[model samples]
Target: MKEKQFTTRAVHAGERADFSQINSVVTPIYPSVGYTFADSHELDAVLGGEQPGYVYSPRYANPTVAALETAVANLESAEAAIALPSGMAAVHLALLGAGVRAGSHVVVAADIYGATYSLVQGIFTELGATVHLVDVLDLKKIEAILAQEKVSALLVETISNPLMKVADLPKLAELAHVHHAKLLVDNTFCSPYLCNPLTFGADMVIHSATKFIGGHGDVMAGLVATSAELKAEMVRLNKLLGSSLGPFEAWLAHRGLKTLPLRMRQQCQNALHIASWLQTHPKISQVNYAFLPSHPQFELMNQLTNGKGGGAVFSFEVRGAGKPEIFALMDALELIQPATSLGDIYSLTLYPAISSHRSLTPAERHKLGIGDGLLRLSAGIEDVADIQADLAQALNKIGHGFDG
Candidate 1:
């Protein structure tokens, strides 16, 4: 048989077609927290890793969660995958599983998600790991850092949060491998539909399944895809930390995966349309969408995403505005919700200064080009014209300046 297409696999992968007891078309949510053993022999065999069956605890593995993990692993072309309670949990486990420890050296991208920056700078640093944050686009600087320090893992995002900068995954992976370091990618922005970091030589791929994977915004989950050996370590760590995904959330994430290909396609179309329109608006200072030809990494994005239009989220700077004006614009929006989350069925917008990047100091945000007027928009599967109307009216509200 020929290899199935992405959409086909998305719908059918990890499905057990040969179920005997009441075959349901959809995968049923196995809410059982623990699986029973036939006898003591079976339990011992399963516990000792001599048999192929689920253990007594959901933390070790739940049938529903396992199905979701398998589906994501198949999509990512990874050896195995582990599902967790949240994105940050996946990040913490990935770093720890990839051998990041006290007194270890790690390299990370400067323009990463704010929470990620906090985790590395605060938690990891407190644990005695020295993290070198650099602009990943600057190959020379990365090389200099690698030359100076024995790095454990080179962490980066496929498409940076808010800023939408595209990382050169293949090149970064090569650099990491040469220095005996692993390349760990946070693939939440791109998702498996847009990009697969493992295919490009990443040692591990992390996703905030809460965002794109759980497209409806109802469920919160995270996933880490890696080689079998690393996956075992992640699973062990997840079990020990008690951060495994609940069966219900795992089922929701799996259902969300079925429509990922469709959702992602529409999202890319909507983002391109909205980004192009925003660029022409006089009130907009700069747009940070890679699909725009004017973007710095346009070519790289095209090459990496295979012309998928830079996923669904982008950030743009509002001209002549500060926090007050930006707040007014958000308040005036009727269609686009002023929320902190992304990749939902409804269009959403967030203010980076007070939301995603609020962890950083004002000076630090300024250094990273995240200004008070910068707004990150997550284009939803809405009518392009309607989305534009909402954005235009909001911009108009801020155009005349805040009267109060």
Candidate 2:
């Protein structure tokens, strides 16, 4: 079969719509729990793995979930895919399947999502893996870590959460291959529509699909896309750990995925518009969006972003404004939602230090360059002028020595 373009792939791939039965034009939700076999030989084949068949129970495998996996794998252009209960579950399953053993060592980027950081620092470390936090932007620092540490795997996000920093995937992939370590990229921020990490030599790509794939703040799911060999391992680990996503959630993710290309591009446009407006606002501090010319790594961002934009998520410091002042501004905003999670159609904002990375100590946060007054914004598909006006109003009303 010929490879389809991005728009065609997004809408047509894995869309096994049944148009004849009940005249349904979309993929049907297979709300089944068990499958009936024809004879003893079929049952034996399923048990022995001689043939591919669904058996035992629905939690392990369901038709609806299978469609979701196919849809996600197609989006990522990977050999196979799996749907987990949540994005974090996909991360855990991907790591475990990649042979992250008790004595294994991992090199995690410093600007990783806070929950991901805690996972590496607390859980992975406790499990005997020596997790090294790396400054991904500093190639020399990454090289130093790779040379000294016995890194079995290197993990980082395409765009680091809150920080909105982009990792040099090609450089990192080369380094990982040289050191015989698997390169894992969390592509939750810039989905396949923006960049394909595998094309750039990444070994594994994982996502908290709940963000982009769900696209509407309604579902919680995760997806791991990789080579056939790695996907087989992930499947084994997923079944062993019972991290499979529910059928309904998988269906929701698949439903949302069909509109992914349209939604992401719109969100990207809106984000750039808002980010540019914020840069000129006197009350705003430093906005860390790659789309803006003032960004330190604008050149590098252009290379990774492919002109699609700096993604819908970004962060900005409120200068001398403290946590209380920041909270007041966030709460006063009528259009923007003051909540956790992003990639939804509605604008969502959160204080990183207290919300996303609350587990990190003050020293650790300072080391990672996250500030108490920093605000992370997930720009949505709302009208740019309307959103800007609300933010402007909020900043104006709160006058607690607010960064002006």
Candidate 3:
């Protein structure tokens, strides 16, 4: 048979044959913490990696989590994938799996998620790894840093958070390979439905399944897709670190993946419409969405995303407004929810200053162009007109004060 389309794979890729008595269409959740071995010989073989079978502990692998891993791996075109408890766990394990050890040097994008920034600066640095945080948009600067440092890995986001800066993944991958460094991309923002970094030469693709992959914002999970060798290494580290995802959450994430292509398409459409509307509004000073022509990486985004537009998220600045006005605007919204997590069925807005990037100091945030007036919008599957109306009314409140 010919290769199945993306939507088809999203729906059926990792499902097993319906051999049970019930013969359900959906993969049933296996919540058992332990699986009994058939015999001692089988247990030993499985533990020693000589055979393919489950052992006693869920940490080794749960059927549901393995299904999630397989589905994500197929989506990413990776040799294998491992599901974790959260996105941070996946990032940490991916770095370690990619050979980031004590005394190793790594290069990370300066404008990444705040928790990621803290991970490198606070945790990895303490482990004896030297980290160089640079503006990844400037290839010259990255090359300069690579020349001076013996880096083990180059980490960056597929589409940066809040700022919506799209990285040139292929170029970065080339640079990392030339420097004998592995390229690790945080694909949480774009998701595999929108962009697969591994297909563009990234050594590993990481996702916070808590967001797009889960779709509903209920499950907290993460995934790392990579070469088979790295997958093994990450699984080993995952076992040692005890970062295995629960069977229930993994099942939920798997259920979410079945509709990822559908949800992502609607979300992307909504984002494009809302972003375009915001761009023309006098109350908005700037809109940062890769699909917008004004975006510095618009052409690159088109090429990378296959002209589908940026993913579901974009950020815009309220004209002449400070934190007070931004808060009032968020409070005035009737439909759009004021929240932190994204990729839900309902439109949600987040303030980077207080939420995703709050770990960064004020000076650091300002340097990265994440101003107090900037608000990140995660467009949902709602009718574009209704979403636009909510935003317009909120902006009006910002103009006339909260009382009006």
lDDT by residue for model 3 (1-404), tens:
99999999999786665545786677778876655566888878888999987774469888878888999999999999999899999899989998999999999999999899999999999999999998879899898878788989999999998899999999999998998899999999888988889889999999999999999989999999999998888877878788889889999999999999999999999999899988899888899998888899999999888887699999998887778989889999999999879988789998999998898889999999998789999999989999999998878766765222
lDDT of 2 by residue, 287-389 (tens): 8886787877676667876877778898988767877888888889999999779999998999998988999987888788888778999988888888888
Sorted by lDDT (best first), the order is: 1, 3, 2
In candidate 1, how many Å is residue 37 off? 1.9
Q: How close is candidate 1 to the true structure, as a TM-score?
A: 0.94
lDDT of each: 0.90, 0.84, 0.89
Better of 1 and 3 by TM-score: 1
TM-score attained by model 2 = 0.92
| Candidate with maximal lDDT | 1
lDDT of 3: 0.89
Over 122-180, each residue of candidate 1 has an lDDT whose tens digit, in order, gives: 99999999999998798999988888899999999999987888899999998999999
List TM-score per model, in order. Answer: 0.94, 0.92, 0.93
Model 3 TM-score, 2 decimals? 0.93
Give the clashing pairs for model 2: none
What is the clash count of model 2?
A: 0
lDDT of 3 at 215: 94
